[model samples]
Target: MSDFASAAMLRVLVQGMRELGLDPGDAPPGDGEARVQLGLKQGLVQRAVLQGGLACLPLLGRGLRRLAHEPTHQALVAAHSASDLLARWQRLERYVHSRHRCVVEHCDDTQACVRHVTVTGQGAPTAAEDFVVAGVLAALLESIGLRRVSLSFGEQGLFPASDPQGLAQAAAAGASALWQFHWQGRPARGSAPVPGPAAWAQGADPAWAEPVRRAYLHLAADLARPWGLPVLAGAMGLSTRSLQRQLAAQGLSYSRLLAEARCRVAAWRLLYTGDPVAEVGFLSGFSDQPHFTRELQKRVGMPPAAYRQAFAARPVPGR
Candidate 1:
């Protein structure tokens, strides 16, 4: 059991590989509870499976934006403050792997949060696994609207005040690693409203949903550009029609998914970045200024400039 990971985690890796136009023949067979056993080496699982996902993140464009919109992941981000989001993120790990434990702490003065994660019932940790954990944590924090998020394995004199060299050795020996996350000014209201746990549990199928959602995220950054179903299907190793059928089964379509991705990215840029509204629109894959403004008004209920002005002026928490 120490060598085994949950099917959900494996599925994310498989999906990522497919999105990258690579063969996912490495994944174990079957689905559901009976499909729990993933017959692969732990090191391979980390390197090929987990690291593979991270490698394809850039191609997915605005990967965090896609993740932030995921129904289940969104539920975790539905928090009042940075502290609240961190707590929810820890709880969300249970849905990923049963053998892992994530613990988070905040400094009283600096308000910097450190998450120490330990994997019990597992063999020695590899650098690949460490990278995956760090990548996932960074994405989640960004999705919850945190800025200046940084991940480090062992930094000297950081939280818990341990020797950096010893911490690195311990990490290689399968001990916990520390992830440090911070925000500028103070915590502010997250971009989207958090959904209840029940909403997360409903219609949640980790096997299919995880990968398909990942595919959408990978393409999120280029939403303003023209993307055809065939292109997306090719990336996912499916015919255009097959892709359509699969998404339909999950109550999604390529157009809807792309729109949502653009909306989320535009909203994040308007709220967090100083980039011009036109640039945000262009980056979000809008064809032109009018198209961008119209869609943004429709989805966000205001033009980009207005949205930024209204929200950006709000008081930062603990300021």
Candidate 2:
């Protein structure tokens, strides 16, 4: 039976294909020797790239490479325990899969760990798709300084045992894969503390805090659209009054949550993206440039430009 990839994974694959200048429509078949060209031609291979989103894996790896240097990304990886790091990683995975169907599982011993991911409701994956998945996994492990990483497809033994070319060969055989990663020496003491649910809730009750936060994250990027209390309440399947009462129980209000969400997104963009302050403001749902600047200053204690400049000037560690 063929395995399938989730839409979230497919989206990332599509983005990567666009970055690599590959045409998803021209991908080859996924069987026999023809599978060797799976990355290049159209068929199940192409469908996997277009529908499963494996093409975005490479680009996501590249993005992670860059983000590893960003303070926020760095802090996330600086978790004290393997479980903590995995939890944080799971949160990221959930965010990416918000609009799709996928299952991700992580298992960690003290020195070694495995990540098992599968996309439901799809046929078996193509060689090209598996290759991308392996590459993305390798990239993520490398970004976090994991060493001696190995991958195995079911009971087929270590895949891509020696080099990258082997990945295609192994995937040609059609089997599910598991990633194995090892740590060197003592695990480095995390430079940042692992954040609790409270960190995300900002003093709200943990029960409904994550749902409220997730709602904001899902909507934050579309600043030009209307996302008032009624809209958000509807999305959560609650009446406006019910939602309000729930937030009140947690000592939060819809407006405050919205502002906090905008501020969080604005701060990140200000630090990482090269977008102009005004553009960032608009993208973060502010009424105008001045309002964006004012709110940012009020929340972050610095104007957007200054915040960006300050972070930019700080020498990136391990650069």
Candidate 3:
């Protein structure tokens, strides 16, 4: 089975697009079309699907309505690649910019809001220490200068966490947009977009791990905190070193998992909350502010204060 955690991020985007005024007519070419259009480079379309998924969340489908196009009635062989998805998003961003009027303004400190965007492309197989898909999406939004965004593992509405075929088929058929407008243009500010805070997967599943699919479900609300393997191992009745061996057998490591968790937590805290820089660090389990600053800058392309300043300065939409 694939990463269900990652799959849900796309649901957030589909939801976000509808919130932005997207209609069925504005839907872009599917993943298959995107790949064939790009000649199957690598992960482009997949990354774009993931990135657009998140960037479109806060706006709901309104952004999608803005992007809708006449369905390509011509059928072409379907191919899947993450890079092709990213290219499709690049096309979408260009379309959004060209057709819409967007401005970046400042907001009052207390009223400011941080939003995390999550998106995933189609897949049924898991990859190695690569569950940090949300981070990749956040980076995509930042590239377009929407630098004030956070990320979360979305609820894909699929069942049987191990291998939810229903959700996967829905995602493929574009039924993933069911919850796009559920947020109703309401502002969450520092609160998480997901009803309960959700934690993202650090990496791939271990070879010998139990069949439980919702391993990261409890972490949904705790996105602000780093859920380290040591803690998880403690919960799973294994020593940290032993856990390391288990993940190692699957071609992963505790450090890799920790890094993914840390990166995602830092991204959410930095983007969605006005929490003080030091507190953001502490909340994300970074004992040192300097370390947090360095890593956040590396991940977000700027210092926390500057990032917050840029976003907080922007007036809340319609304020």
TM-score of each: 0.42, 0.40, 0.29
Give per-model CA RMSD. Answer: 19.8, 13.4, 21.5
Higher-ranked by lDDT: 1 or 2: 1
Q: Please give, for residues 256-316, the per-residue lDDT of candidate 1 as tens digits.
A: 7777666776676566555445445545555545676789889779887788889864532
> lDDT scores for all predictions?
0.51, 0.48, 0.35
Give one digit per residue, the lDDT tens place, for model 2 in 163-274: 3334445555554344454444323554332222113324322466665655555445333334678877886787989878777876778888778767876776665555
Give the true-structure RMSD of model 3.
21.5
Candidate 1 at residue 34, lDDT?
Answer: 12
Residue 80, model 2: lDDT of 39
- Which pairs of residues have clashing backbones in candidate 1? 60-218, 78-194, 223-285, 224-284, 224-285, 224-286
C-alpha-based local distance difference test score of model 1: 0.51
